[model samples]
Target: MKKLILPFLCIFLLVSCKNETKQGDSNSNELGTAVKDTVIVEVPKVPIEKTIKEIKEALTAKGFKTFEYVDETTKDTILMQQYFMAFLKRSAIKMQNEEESERLQKLHMEHLSKMHELGYADISGPFGDDGDISGVTIYNVPTLKMADSLAKSDPMVQAGRLEIEIHPWWAAKGIGLR
Candidate 1:
């Protein structure tokens, strides 16, 4: 997150030069005419193409792996983006009481919901069987480090009830399950 903010902050500081003149302040000219304080702010006009380019550029800037492929049937360009699959596994710690366990479970669900709401996770679900791997979450983040951090931020993982194993995965940029 800091990586995302610093660069934009620097650019904003550089481009955002504002005149120090106040509203009521009037600096007289050589002729003693009243000079009104004026400030210039240029709002950029972005077209659709430029927006698309910026999205691609941002993805690349974030160290995301992406590629475009021409579909044979429709001859349309398809963007394939890399995602991370987090395997939520069982941890050694299981000492929580019933009430505490219930609370942690609720918090865990809330965390997952927030991740989905924030577009950080594409999909997440638990496994049916009682196995070492408990659940899986597909993270729609740019880098493995980001996915790892988000996964570690899960309440269950932080409580030592679950462990995380992540791997790089890929899919169509805008494709959804049927």
Candidate 2:
């Protein structure tokens, strides 16, 4: 008889414990809204192509022309924290002669092309509208000193026919060959 009573009490205890857990799970808030164990949140994802298109749209709206090139390895987008920007502007000093100016122009083009080929210059172009600023060049160099050296190496800049203003620029990386 004692053995039977002990087993029954154990069973009763187990049943009572399960019922308490169920009751606790069903408890509601003050407003009578049942609580949920887990909440599902929906998040929207943007494709890389869509993001790039939107960026191009914003740039075009502000009179910026963008160029793109493909990378052979790693298809992931290259986002960079900072870069160097060189602003090419006409200096106050005049060239010695038209021939000298032409010679300097050729040398300048060669220098720019070499930089572009060596993976230093990512983008460079003249301003479409006439302004004090002649053109702009973006470099992937790591330091200001390197960028300054590059600018100073230009024949036009060295000859004082053109002046360069270097500034730290923020840009997205891996857009082009650089």
Candidate 3:
């Protein structure tokens, strides 16, 4: 029994290591050069900075709600712009297979990319914790109806995996997330 166990262990280790060695040899160059993995990140294009008057003019031209006030400390005129926030909540039907789920997720990302490219959604992402609310998309559009239409176009939302609840959100113009 001892002799049999020794041979079995030896064969197991030899077979396991042989496959790894073969895999390594197949990836090596003639000169045995090392390979490095590369990662690429896509940066969104930011629009040119506009003056306060220009921003107010643009917002008013688009029929958006805005209010201004002077800060006591800085004394700078603060321009508040109303944006729409779409809360992506988990829906009742969560019955998609893995393949269908993957396809829907891909389509959802494409929809988000198009929104960003069209300057409709300022930012979108999922929540860290698993909760009723899954994600949110901040729409830079002026009207709630337009924002609702955009959110409804998402594949996940259409497929009954998620639901959208839109609300008006306000923030200072030209302000960015820290």
The best candidate in terms of lDDT: 3
Ranking by TM-score: 3, 1, 2
Per residue, candidate 1 scores C-alpha lDDT tens digits across 1-178 of 9998999998877665332222223565555555767568987696435443566678899788888788999997777889999999999999999999999999999999999999999899999999999999999898899999999999999999999999999888777999
- Candidate 3 stretches greater than 4 Å from native: 1-49
On residues 1-178, what C-alpha lDDT tens digit does candidate 2 reach at each position?
Answer: 9999999999999999777666664556655556777578977696435556565566556444454444459675443335789999988889479888888889999999999999778888889987889999987676788888998898989999889999988755434553
Report the Cα lDDT for residue 86, model 2.
Answer: 96
Output the lDDT of residue 5, model 3.
100
Q: Ranking under lDDT, best-scoring first?
A: 3, 1, 2
Cand. 1 Cα-lDDT: 0.88
Would you estimate the TM-scores of all the predictions?
0.66, 0.53, 0.71
The CA lDDT at 128 in model 3 is 96
Q: Which structure is stronger by lDDT: 1 or 3?
A: 3
* Whole-model Cα lDDT of every candidate shown, in order: 0.88, 0.77, 0.90
Clashes per candidate (backbone, < 3 Å): 0, 0, 0
Question: What lDDT is reached at residue 89 by model 2?
Answer: 95
Identify the superior model by lDDT, candidate 2 or candidate 3.
Answer: 3
Q: Which ten residues in a row have the lowest lDDT in candidate 3?
A: 26-35
**Model 2 alpha-carbon drift over 4 Å, by segment:** 1-78, 176-178
